[model samples]
Target: MKKLFTTDFKQRCINLMLHEQHTVAETSKIMNVSISALQRWKVQYIKEKQGITPVKPAITAEQREIQRLRTEVEQLRSDNALLKKVSAFFLDKH
Candidate 1:
């Protein structure tokens, strides 16, 4: 029998490899997934990033929402940092 993995689990594995800078071998051992599966997931992730639909393990709606929110949070943080710099500059002038 084959083991079925959840979308969230797959996403976490990809994140570990991409964001955390883990090698495929390390991710496979740590996540207990096969190297082949990790490679496939990486390909799918790249395709998705390029705006192409993946062949399998399609990203769920919830995952898409989370990604969107993460991007929004990053943008907001950048804006906040700029605002703080501007405020400090004005304070120094006055």
Candidate 2:
């Protein structure tokens, strides 16, 4: 997955957390995300708004592709492992 810069993620997260009155865990769950992930985003937002350098905005397609590819790669790895085991069984003598 692409690493989000500190500021932008934080700002969006704050928007969600504050205006929505979302709990750390609840917000994360509704978004299908982890609490620590949102927490980190919150930190980055605060740090940047406090005077740190700005983070670039994320593209939806790019983020979607990142998640998709990560899942695909994992599945491919698992399939390859199974194939390797099957091949080994076929090649080995009893």
Candidate 3:
């Protein structure tokens, strides 16, 4: 995949495509991003541009902690399995 673009550049391109009513091809050409990529951003921009203020991402700290705990649990389970295999190998040899 191509390198990700900066937030400002992407928003600028989306604004041009949405607010200024520029064609996706023209916006992509001006912003130097792929037309398909520009189209995707335009979809999001158009959705949120409706009412007074923009809605922010809804993730909470508790949700983030839950995700972190899930990852740690997966890692610990993997480590325990490896340790069990090692212990069984030593027992079998001795």
The estimated TM-scores of all candidates read 0.61, 0.44, 0.48
**All candidates: CA RMSD (Å):** 12.2, 11.6, 8.7
How far is 66's C-alpha from truth in model 1 (Å)?
Answer: 15
| Cα lDDT of model 2 by residue, 9-31, tens digit | 44456677867888888777676
Candidate 3 local lDDT, 3-56, one digit each (tens): 777656777887787679999999878878888887766665554444212233
Native-referenced Cα lDDT, model 1? 0.83
Instruction: Judging by lDDT, tell me the better candidate of 1 and 2.
Output: 1
Looking at model 3, the pairs that clash are none
Q: Best-fitting candidate, measured by TM-score?
A: 1
- Clashing residue pairs in candidate 1 are none
Candidate 1 per-residue C-alpha lDDT over 14-89 given as tens digits, one digit per residue, 9 for 90 to 100: 9999999999999999999999999988887777776665445465454466567777999999999999999999
TM-score of predicted structure 2: 0.44
Q: What Cα-based lDDT does every candidate model obtain?
A: 0.83, 0.64, 0.68
Candidate 1: where is the Cα deviation over 4 Å?
60-94
TM-score order, best first, reads: 1, 3, 2
